[model samples]
Target: MSKLKVAVIGCGSIAKHRHLPEYAQNKQVEIVAVCDIVEERVNEFATKYDAIAYTSYEELLANQDIDIVSVCTPNYLHASISVAALKAGKHVLCEKPMATSKEEAEEMIREAEAAGKKLMIAHNQRFVPAHQKARELIEKGELGKLYSFRSAFGHGGPERWSVDGKDSWFFRKEEAFIGAMGDLGVHKTDLLRYILGEEFVEVGAFVETSSKKNADVDDSAVCVLKTENGIIGTLAASWSYVAKEDNSTIIYGEKATLRLLDDPINSLVIQYIDGAVVKYELGGIQTNDIGGQSSSQVIDKFVHAIIQNEESPVSGSEGLKSLQVVLSALESNETKRIVTI
Candidate 1:
């Protein structure tokens, strides 16, 4: 069995920290090509990884040897690039906020299905160790009958970590299509869906741009969400956490309250109603503060899915569902009404 050849479509921060390095670590993969509009960035990656460099993604996609495409471009380009890659007979592993619109997300899924290629969205929160452990315990009914939860992912802002700093496309609506909600909020939305095995049915939100100056998009957003099973809670995404990054979730249930990624020493803690407590130092959740972790498990799952012809763990459909929740939150913020998913 020959190694699968991969071409990364964008050489941005995500490509540098997560997709590129993680794919290189996969023994079954070969980093065949890298592309970015910036020649210097692409050339740097190509030199580092021993792959061909291209300033145009289309030209890179034209390479017949590439079996996989990692779409690490901005939010606005996710749908188009993934669709093109699937049409070109390549499996796609796209970054989060898979598309800026619900319609776009559906089209990407449709194209992947038409091409019979796997389409995965990089919602890595579901792959975190503490998150995986929490899901397992929830499935086993340890956190019986989940009632409510609060999940937040906030940091100093993308400018601190993005390759272009303050000039990064993340703060530009034309490229990002959203700010903190799409960048950070979507992760928590997807994780809640995965951990609780439920879908968010309704949302009412307050999305604002109060924190970051001169940015047209929201830097802070707070959403009240209700799941299909009647569980309700708050989801927050902010670029205003000037001191430290807070990527934490607290789940309330009839049996026990699960605290995930909240404590510095213990990644997961279970506090029972009867006063019994349990703690597990699973591992730290990936953060921009540390330039992310070495392995998110997302790349590995995507590789295995393609090799074994199995459905992706974070499939296009799953991505669309999560995108819908965020879209609903945006709509709710504007309409001042609870939006139903």
Candidate 2:
């Protein structure tokens, strides 16, 4: 089969670190075009990958040969770019959270359906080996009626990691909509739903701009969720941690408990009430150029889905679910009360 001709809509950190590298590595994809508002970055990527570069995403979307479009733009532009690409008869792989608001997400979904194109979101945590194993265990009923869970994701800040540093959209509420909640929190939101196989029903949250000078967005946020199945959990996401700690999940079930940690390699520990414990080490999950191990897995899955004409594990609808959790959290924080999904 010929390679799927792909175009990237944003040449930011995520595009450089995850999407471009993974697409370059995948034998099934031909990254034919790259687009970014920043001409220099787009040109550099185009030269490195031997692809055409565009200063505007609309120009790239006009290219009839492009089969896939990866929307790696800011949260606010996700819906517009994705809807345009889908309407242009191209499959789309959008980054999470799917959009700045639920209405936007719904519009994108509607457009994709109308165009009869696949719409996948980059909720890569679902592809992590530890997360995959947890899902498997839960599906097998080994956890035995989950009672509750806890998860968190934190890092220093985007200033050090983003190519734009302090000027990155991450620090701007207009472009980012929300800070740590949308950036790091959504991953946990998606991961919890993937592992638990339940949707969040209600949320009560607290968000603050506790650190980061001159930033208008929250640097730290915490939320408690009640799942539709009666499982309750807490998620903490922050940009204040000096060192990264992607620690996640303590699922308490009737017969046993499971713990997941991404650092020091992806490891899962399961303990039973009868004094038996099991440990699984997933080693490295092939994160692209960055430390996003699950991203590599996600790209691989995306390519497979394109080749097989199948549904993505992290579908656009699944991404919307996570975004709904974030929106609910924001509403809860603003209202000082629980918000229903």
Encode model 2's per-residue lDDT on 131-248: one tens digit a residue: 8898999899998989998898887888877888888998999999999999989998998988898899999999999988968999999999999989998999998987555556
Which digits, one per residue and each the tens of the lDDT, describe model 1 over residues 225-260?
A: 999989999999999999999999999999999999
True-vs-predicted CA distance for residue 85, candidate 2, Å: 0.5
Error of 2 at 284 (Å): 4.6
Error of 2 at 98 (Å): 0.8
Off by over 4 Å in 1: none
Name the best candidate (by lDDT).
Answer: 1
lDDT of model 2 at position 26: 88
lDDT of 1: 0.93
Query: What stretches of model 2 exceed 4 Å from their correct place?
Result: 262-266, 284-295
lDDT of 2 at 38: 89
Clashes of 2: 1
Any residue pairs clashing in model 2, and if so which? 287-293
Among all candidates shown, the one with the greatest TM-score: 1
